[model samples]
Target: MAQNIIHLVNVSKNYNGTEALRNINLYIRKNEFLTLLGPSGCGKTTTLRIIGGFEAPDGGEVLFNGVNITSVPPYKRRVNTVFQKYALFPHLNVFENIAFGLKIKKMDKKLIAEKVHNILGLVNLSGFEQREIDSLSGGQQQRVAIARALVNEPEVLLLDEPLGALDLKLRQEMQIELKNMQQRLGITFVYVTHDQEEALSMSDTIVVMKEGSIQQIGSPIDIYNEPKNSFVADFIGESNIVSGIMLRDYLVKFAETTFECVDHGFKENEPVDVVIRPEDIQVVPAAESKLQGEVSAVTFKGVHYEMIVQNNSTRWKIQSTAMAPVGAKVGLQILPEAIHIMKKVTVK
Candidate 1:
């Protein structure tokens, strides 16, 4: 088992009386890629700031290697942050920017050169050492920011939406590059982002957050497949969520239909929320299946067709390779495993 390298114990923070984090308890394993994911004001960034020593929590402890370091300053911690804004010095060349920290420590001049060269190579900018910061593209500049942080050889790296400024294609490319870099370096990465796809693709563990609290923490697969509630299901991907009742073990009733699902442990006849992914639903001929709907809207989504099916008051979004014309009656087939059942939440 991997040992934890960082822990946030009952951490709470507030910004001018508005709670930013409430009793957040988290454990980050050494050398793992963990992402704190949520929408704006959900405390993901605040949590990252706390870990990076940028902000101290109103209450609780921040531990590094099981040692409390809540009050430690950012510069004293063995971690560096890469923000959305690269913050590269406009007048400095790539080498100078990356070597700034090493020079501050007054390391051997030759050793600083060696570290800068090595980090530049790692970030695929080996030949751009003398290039002025302003001459580099956005992606290259972001890489320089990362290279600067890595050149410090910190044990952990904190990233706050580092890819947020890039174009769609560049952002997608950097997502893969960042994951590869983390794996190659064998260090802990604590990332903060609101992009669900980015979190799912790059993180080993994903912590879902909501207003001032952590909602769930699990592997990307677990978080996507077995969401704890409707919010996670809706946020992580395209889901058809509706009110349901657990009729009995392995049985659920929703949309006036009783179906067999692989969910249990709920009280008999208990209310629940059923989450069905758009990709899990198969579009079939209406005559062959029991549940039917009219395809009210259809759009080609490159890999598949996204069809909005209307069955009276409920609208379901489904993705399938087979195209069903709008206004045509179609059937939806949801397998037992795809029918994830989550406990319902009460609205405020």
Candidate 2:
């Protein structure tokens, strides 16, 4: 079993009169790429800051390897942070930027040189050592920031939406690169991002948060496939969430029709929320489909068509390679496994 490198016990934070984090409990495994994922104002960055020792929690304790570090200063913790803006000094060259931490520690010049040389090679910027910060592109600057953090040889690295400044293509490329680097280095990575795709692509485990509390924590596949609630299903990916009733094991009723499903363990006649991914729905001829609807809208999404179909009063977003023109009648076929049932949320 992987050991827990960091643990947050009933951690809470408040700013002004508003609550930012409400009883957050999390455990990060050693050498795992974990992502704190949520939309803005959801406390993802606040949690990261707390873990990095930049902010103190109003309640609870932070444990690193079973040792409480709640009062430890940021500089004293064996962790480094890479901010979204990179924070590279404009006056320093790439080599100097990476070597800045070592110099602050008053390390031997030869040792700093060796460490800088090796990290530059690790980030694939071996020959760009003397290049000025302004001379590098956005992606290169991100690499320099990561290299600087890694040069400190910290046990854990905290990243605060580090790819937020990059373009779509560059951000996608960096997602893969960062995941590979984490595997190669075998160090714990606590990454913060609002981008769902980034969390899905790079994380060994994803902690999905909303409104200052965690919604779910699981592997990407698990979180994407078996969401615990409507919030998680809707946030993790494109989902068609609708009210439904579980008729029995392997049977559910939604859209005023009963359909076979692969989920069970629900009480008979229990109210639930049903989720079906856009990609899981197939468009077929209206005459052969279980549900018939008219194509209300269609958009060319490069690799596939993003289509909206209206069945009664429900609008379902579907992704398919087949182009169904608006006003055309179509059938939506969903496999049994595609039907996900979540418990309904009750309000006080």
Against the true structure, whose lDDT is highest?
2
Q: Candidate 2, which segments miss by more than 4 Å at Cα?
A: 134-137
Instruction: Please provide TM-scores, in order, for all candidate models, with all chains considered together.
Output: 0.95, 0.94
The parts of candidate 1 lying over 4 Å away from their true place are none
Local accuracy of candidate 2 as per-residue lDDT tens digits, 155-265 = 899999998878898778778877888888888999999888899989999999988989899999999999999888998999999999999999999987789999899
- lDDT against the true structure, each candidate: 0.91, 0.92
Clash pairs, candidate 1, are none
RMSD of 1: 1.5
Give each model's clash number.
Answer: 0, 0
